[model samples]
Target: MSDRIVESCRMCESSDLESVLDLGSTPPSDNFLTLEQLNKSETYYPLRLVCCKSCGLSQLSYVVDRETLFNPDYPYESGTSKFFRDHFEEMAASVTGKLNLAADDLAIDVGSNVGILTAAFQRNGVRSLGVEPVGRLAEKANMAGAETVHAFFDPDIGQKVRDSHGAASVITATNVFAHIDDLNAFVETIKILLKPTGVFVSESPYLLDLVQNLEYDTIYHEHLSYYSVAPMRSFFDRHGMEIIDVHPVDMHGGSLRTYVAFKGAHEVSESVGRYLANEKEQRLQDPEALKKFGAKAAAHKAELFEFLYELKREGKRIVGIGAPAKGNTFLNYCNIGPEILECLTEKAEAKVGLFAPGTHIPVLGDDFLENEQPDFGLLLSWNLKNEIMNNLSAFSAAGGKFIIPIPNIEII
Candidate 1:
């Protein structure tokens, strides 16, 4: 239950950090509570963002204990969403073809949750392994036929993995890259696990998109860094690695997929330069711009809360659509609870019977939408609104509307 305030930038170790956005304190986003645990006290940590003046990297101002944040019973399962499953499948196929990986070449997925990407790699005819920290998830991945090692990824684990299965041809850290607090150590681990010619690909929510789209809800304890091409290129270059390519992917609102290789191991793509130029054009690193973003987020929060209150006054019943971890941040920040959201519907069996971390909104199966027929559904997982809305078409057909509260407050 220990946490500490970060006084220096994680990427460049710069003490010249500027506070950008402060969302106050929040309980761990994934700490879904059991009925018995609801009555007990819950811990809350500071949820604030700061930008480094030296490297232009955006990161959290506080560091929550890794053990507390990612307990053995971590509830998120990447395979639970069909959208993510399909995305990972596409990622594996694309990386395999681009790298000309053969069946003999090994692919390792770092922080592979339930081995979704690892399984996708195996399906692509390459031998794949998953490195996951949570024992429960590792066991689940093994049961699903995706061999996984249950240990936190570091130089030691990387050496053992390389010794057992040979250096990896491709290593991926999709959405998990930003969760790392120690960027330097992580890169060292990547170097140890990868062959000289191997490529390390990381996909994370781009800081540019987060600021432009007012995606403040995505700021949580687990996501330490909000990566952009400029800072990422600088960081990799310092480690004697180069970003060979960069691509924007449509996942988790918006994400940047970066391909890294040992210096001169691969040809640099024009996309990297384009992304860097775009980031500069948008003033992604300007401290003033980030402060403005914080102001915009505060304004949006007010507007959304007012709108929801108005709807409630009109006697409309509202329930949350998807109980994603980011949704917990929004719920707690906006102070929306079971009073406003009757319940939250989720597809993950693990979360269905539990309650949201801070808001304590009951999580029920998606079937609850059809059975309860609430008047309006607050789309907590707004990134997957299309998929969820399409899946819950029956709810819409029954004259129910949806409220999308991110970027803007809209009823669709």
Candidate 2:
């Protein structure tokens, strides 16, 4: 009955924290279970956001433990989206060229899901290694011929990597940087692993973009910290590193691809200065902006539930589309259970055979939408609305409505 122990900000260890938003209590997104497991009492954990006054880092303080986040049979395959794979390839080429990497140089990827970008490095004859915490994903990366380490990346592991691979010429984390609970430890690891001339590159959904785009669904327990150029620069500077270059990539809605290097080893690019200026001008660090974002998200939840409830009252069959991780946050936040939606549809066979995390909504194959002919489909993965709608042209032709909730509420 007591409150769970709270985690301190990895950067500042400031207990001076306040909740920005509480998506109520919810189960971890990746804890999809068997039907028998479903019969047992389900457990829920708090999905709360907190802002650190000292460090200016927005984070979730509860640690759900890594086992819940990265299961052996984690169903999300990075290769499922060709669009993401292509982006990884292009990114590898661009960064390699920019860093002027030699054929013999080594590249290390932390949490390299399926080794997509690492494979790109291997193609150019650069020795590549991937460190993945999840057993299944690490196994997949190893099978793909990338030297895979089946463990989490931290200061110790970073040292081991440097000992073996002779200091990575380049280190990268794609959509994986935000999951670490220990920002100081993570940066220390990156510093120890990099060669004197090595660059640490990361791509993460920008906090600015998240607020501007109303991407409240991106708030999951796993993503403990959100990043922007401002906080990141300060975080790295403490460890004798410099933000050298930055490029905004269009993956995962909108993301910032950042490059950093050892202190005084590389020229701090003008882009870093420009980005900091922009952040100051826009007041991204202002606490009021974040407070406003929390309000906007609540309004979105209210609008979405009102519309869906009206549909249910009309005796219309409503089904959800794509059981994405973000969808779990939205569903739990809005209290949308099977009563509101019969079930959800997913393209992946693994997810289709399982149930949604918190709501326990039975996840069915895409055929469910095609055959059963739902009156309205709530596009849970609104980020991929264009792709899902295009693929479900048959449903649209059959007079089905698609409801997308985020940025703008629209029915197509």
Clashes of 1: 0
Q: Write the per-residue lDDT of candidate 1 for residues 1-412, one digit (tens) a residue.
A: 3677889988888899999999999999999999998999999999999999888999999999999988987899999878999999999999999999999999999999899999999999999999999999999999999999998888889899989999999999999999998788889999998999999999999898898899999999999999988888888999999999999899998998999999999899999889889888988988888999999998988888889888899999999999999999999998898889999999889998999998899999999989989999999999998898999999999999999888888888
Which 10-residue span in candidate 1 carries the lowest summed lDDT?
Answer: 1-10
Tens digits of per-residue lDDT for model 2 on 1-412?
1234465665667777767777787887767777878888777887877777766677776867766678686777777766777888898888888888887899998898788988998886688899988888888888988778988887888888888878889999998888887677788898888889999999988888888888888888778787778878887888888899997888776899999998899887899989889877876766666888889899989998998999999999999998888889889899899999999998877787788877889999999988999999999888778878999999999999998888878888
User: Highest TM-score among the candidates is held by which one?
Assistant: 1
- TM-scores for every predicted model: 0.99, 0.95
Q: Local distance difference test, per candidate? A: 0.92, 0.83
RMSD, candidate 1, Å:
1.0
